[model samples]
Target: MPAKDKMDKTKMVTCTAPVNIAVIKYWGKRNEELILPINSSLSVTLHQDQLKTTTTVAVSRSFQDDRIWLNGKEEDIAHPRLQSCLREIRRLARKRRNDGAAGLDSTGLSHKVHICSVNNFPTAAGLASSAAGFACLVYTLAQVFGVEGELSGIARQGSGSACRSMYGGFVQWIMGNTDDGKDSLAQQVEPETHWPELQILVLVASAERKPVGSTSGMQTSVQTSCLLKHRAESVVPGRMVEMIEAVRKKDFPAFAELTMKDSNQFHATCLDTYPPIFYLNRVSQQVINLVHRYNRHYGETRVAYTFDAGPNAVIFTLRQHVSEFVHVVQHFFPPETNGGDFIKGLPVNHTALSEELKQGIGLEPMPKGVSYIISTKVGPGPCVVEDPSQHLLASDGLPKECV
Candidate 1:
């Protein structure tokens, strides 16, 4: 006889959401339930180019149980963050149904959501995977269930930064004063079309993988790192103002300065942690030096760099400087001489593609082929796409039983 199985036996409902990158990072939280941050953070909406997660969330009575397939692999739905979002969304959904807002045509849509997410890039490689995943998950769920009212408010309960991911271009996560977190949500400051001249070049650092996850690392820092207090109180508030003004004015010099400084300070706090979590590897460090030298050599700031939970670099520059930035980053990673023997899931370093690894260690001119480069720019905020087939899960709002 076949082994017994356990899961909700029902059909499924489906939807998808894009990822986003922050200009002013969301580092810590104030309210966990409402997913409110201690301070306001801003972000540039990353274009859905090479890096993004396509999540199809489904719900239905035919489904056996709640399930998620991220990048084609089934993931445990036991994480507290995941659990909280699901519970909250479900509660809101029931309210909507009882309120008669649920569309009569789709009666089973609100019951269950089977989420299937595929990240175009490596998830563990640390390019803000959770930000994209949670944002997409929440956005898609709201759409599938026909639940309404301020989508960002719901997304916030998923992750502090996730709210910003709901929109593209310049976004602000308002640090609202509501104790219930009802007022704390993300709003679009500007659309991607407002900054067409800005360009982003992502530098893939060591594919070796991150040593510390952001959630755990942040918790550790919050508990032990004293500098974090100063950062939260004094540093970020001023930097947020300057960064916003710089974006508004398109001031490269000021933008670069604040970005690099904030990044360095964030990393410094990481070092201040008792266990000392190292997110940036030697390659990431070299890229930092390389960017510094590029700006110095040019006699002005032409580019800016920001890092998320991982060491991979997101370089911001005007369209005018993108060719120069791309040329410099691309030469850092070329194909290995063995020709096509490269491995997936393994971290790729700037030096691995470089001919001379030792000499390429510092701020020296980047060797050709040391790194892989992707060119994208800011994008717009979240919008609900009406087509159901676009969703990842079954029409019944569940993952296909086969998957």
Candidate 2:
């Protein structure tokens, strides 16, 4: 091919983004199209090494039209949210060019794009996969187009929680009151380094898809649940303040308590909705009780559990408590049901559980309640993958591997 043709053939970028679990949940949306939340919320971005989505965006003149393949399955690119993200990114690029900021060739700017994204973890598990997915998508698209600066707003249009995944460490989605959502944006409260001892565990209660999707669930809650309105107005603002303070101070108990309370309230609002949506099941309830029992046995809050639109539990604790918590989890949700290790990802230090300690909590064993546990910690935000080997798409703009 000619040099110019080769140059226009494929320009690509790959990026990875980490999933985040809200400490003070963002349950209701004030604006569905803009994805503006009713109240500000905070979350700890989980380590990318354990839970994340890797995405590649390639724009080539030869490509016929915009397309996307998620987890190797072709998906409609015309999805309203996806279109929103694409429109915003292209608009930014066009604005920059018209303003004489910087510009890529017009053909490259207008060329169709092929996107491939895959999550290392199970998509059906309801692990806020969309948060990381959209963050990476917007980030990679911006990189390919050579546009930079605040992009959480663009990601927010794809998924409300996605905006927070744009930053690493501790982040907050400020619920701006402006009608246009111009002030509604995600901000970083602290870098990942601020809390070295803070650890996170994902307790996989059930990998199956959530019964109620967040979009419809929140819509129903907004229309039917008065408790949701109350929490959005009366509860979340205070929790956001305390959660930020607790994170900054690296106060485990304060953070843990706040995390648990907010999660419980989020679920409570779900219950309050007409024709209640149940995200938590027997296993989820058991995990909640076990966490409280373990903390009560120690007479202190060493662990906290948060659920995000699913039955799975995202546990937060400090490094010192990780080993014991894993042991406790293993004891209650025995791996014998699956005939394998209950723990995956970051290895836990072997600790002999005192029979007395296990007996003290006095909870009946719920074998196979949890499929497995992913041990991880707070980590950085979206990142560009420089290595060619990591790209999920080929030079021809086709997926390299299927998930």
Candidate 3:
């Protein structure tokens, strides 16, 4: 190959992965290195249209070493989790080549790679940014290397919940008993189209990074929180079964009840930790109260709130209730900006808050408790973006945004 051709021979792929909200949460890891959860967990993958991470990976002979840029800032490519993902993907590619898999690029395997990833949502704010980020990273790299099939296990090595983001709609991360962690993988419980009536509203209490990261939080919980151990060993198994059944049956009430209970329990375990990690702020507590009051006034579970390792509340409700629930949120947590600015993603119709409804809940308005709300629904898993313009990295193996 000519020098110019060799320089131009960049094998690149770009992909987007969705953030996921766990209903039956995964709190602790049995094997920290492998990211094997202590218990099974189920989650709903939010639509990429609302929340996603886009990643581009390019491999070329001209590149000197593995490099990475995240959200326009250069990050340490030598990070262990990153190296784990990179090593695994290369191992798979080499294995394929050894097995005489068609279209295997023998030379490209030795080339350096440039990676650029950015999230539409806030990172480390408990919105599962790492889930989408690492999922996109592993996925785009796999596509670039001509590798495919069951990449969730590899994504898990990067972030435990990342495996769940590898699939759309309802997903369950099975905590396999194997020491090698081969059986511990994500499996889709249902496709994106399975629950069209169900809608999700991410109440962004704060976009700022959480006080404690999930990795560190989970580590502490595993070591100190006996509640975490019991929940993982006892509660999660039963809830996982119920959650899966609720998702399959499209039982909103059952699903909502389980979601709220599991979320509450997850946080309780956080409190039970030796040092006690506080992920939820006053805003999160208010959201939780509002959700229950809203459901109570209706004498049923119309809405449910779940928080991860941050103050942001992820609410699940039916499409019909979205307008009213959003309005309710607005009434309680009055935004600093206009309604249009307060809500992002899918448009929500204006719904008048009735005096009866307001009086029933009777909560004092907290101005700007939530920054904004992201209205989205169940959506597909990681997807390849064929459009060259969508690539985060330029043809020269640098972040387009930075350039």
Worst 10 residues of 2 by lDDT: 335-344
Order candidates by lDDT, high to low.
Answer: 3, 2, 1
lDDT of candidate 1 over 1-403, digit per residue (tens): 3322223443334444456777676776666556677677878888775456677765556667788887766889877888887777777777876777735334554454567877777676767777777887887666666666777877777667778888878888888888998888888877788778887877766554678877677778878888887888888888888888987887778877887788888788889888887888766787787788667766788888887778788888887777645545554444343323322221233333333432343344434323455567776555555676665666455445454
lDDT of 1: 0.69
Among the numbered candidates, top lDDT falls to 3
Comparing 2 with 3 on lDDT, the higher-scoring candidate is 3
Cα shift from native, residue 403, model 3 (Å): 2.7
Candidate 3, RMSD to the unseen true structure: 1.1
Q: Tens digits of per-residue lDDT for model 3 on 137-210?
A: 99999988888788999999999999999999899999999999999999999999999999999999998988
lDDT of 2 at 121: 88
Candidate 1 stretches greater than 4 Å from native: 1-14, 32-34, 102-106, 332-371, 383-391, 394-403
Candidate 1: 10-residue stretch with minimal lDDT: 339-348
Ranking by TM-score: 3, 2, 1
lDDT (10s digit) by residue, model 2, range 303-386: 999998999999998899999889889888887654246788888987778988888889989878888999999999999999
> What is candidate 2's CA lDDT for residue 272?
98
Task: Show the lowest summed lDDT stretch of 10 residues, model 3.
Answer: 3-12
lDDT of each: 0.69, 0.90, 0.93
